[model samples]
Target: MGFNPKDAIESVKDIATNAVERSADIVESAGYIIKGDVSDGVVGIVSSSMDIATHSVEKIKEIATGRDEDVDEIGG
Candidate 1:
């Protein structure tokens, strides 16, 4: 076997290219996963905020009307 510099350089280039391509694919997949997780988290926060808003409004209404019925209903 002969130590050919040209062949060694070509082989190194090919390996580096393959490694870069594989790394890019992994990074792309991870980006998609992170995006999905952020989307789900935003939806959860929005849903919780809406629920809190509705409950607050209901409580205010009950207090303004001096209603004991709502509290009694919950206790029952």
Candidate 2:
């Protein structure tokens, strides 16, 4: 099939998610925080991917759950 942006996004999202989860596991095993502030630490682990899929998911949940009024940025 031709290139698919959705598939690309999903793959990056999975990668970021794995990084976050793996980092969390490491933190839990060591009984200490990963690095920096908790929120930044998690994002830092995923930042290398240069994809916003995870953040978009978070923003959507924030809006849907009423945790925030809207996404930090509109749709890509």
Candidate 3:
């Protein structure tokens, strides 16, 4: 089959998502190790922030690549 641009874009998205998730995990782990009990609140905030950042990145990528689909959903 010929190269499909959509599939390539999806693959790139998957890679970026994995990288962001891994970074979040590392940050959470470090927070826990450093803050002990207080890390719970900090981790929650960090996780949500990461989710928003990921969603924003995806929207930017979609716009940059000229994908016209509406991105009304956040952290899907």
Candidate 4:
């Protein structure tokens, strides 16, 4: 078979374009595609912070309503 130079160049261009399209599809499907495992870290930190804040609020309430002593001063 005889090879045509123009056809070869067009084939190469098609391949490059196809590769680029496939790559774009993969990237778009994967979402933002940032540099780190940001999900695990952000979720863990937010959840742990919420837990700590809840516990602290409970502690403050308990202190504001002391069992042994009258909390007259602490009451609003």
Q: Would you give me the overall lDDT of model 3?
A: 0.63
Clashing pairs in 1: none
Tens-digit lDDT track for model 2 on 28-69? 534423433666545554553333455556544553444433
User: Using alpha carbons, what is the TM-score of model 3?
Assistant: 0.39
Off by over 4 Å in 1: 1-36, 68-76
Off by over 4 Å in 3: 1-37, 68-76
Candidate 2 wrongly placed segments (more than 4 Å): 32-76
For model 4 the TM-score comes to 0.41
Instruction: Name every residue pair that clashes in candidate 4.
Output: none
Clashing pairs in 3: none
**Candidate 2, 54: how far from true, in Å?**
19
- Report lDDT (Cα) of residue 17, candidate 2: 74
Best by lDDT: 3
**lDDT per residue, candidate 1, 1-76, as tens digits?**
3345565555456555555655555555556557786665555555545555555555444554445245446546
lDDT of each: 0.53, 0.51, 0.63, 0.49
Quick one: ranking by lDDT, best first?
A: 3, 1, 2, 4
Error at 73, model 1, angstroms: 17
TM-scores for every predicted model: 0.41, 0.36, 0.39, 0.41
Question: Which ranges in model 4 have alpha carbons more than 4 Å from their true place?
Answer: 1-35, 67-76
Model 4 RMSD, rounded to 1 decimal: 29.9
Q: Candidate 4, residues 4-63: lDDT per residue as tens digits?
A: 555555555655555565555445434533546567545555554555555445444444
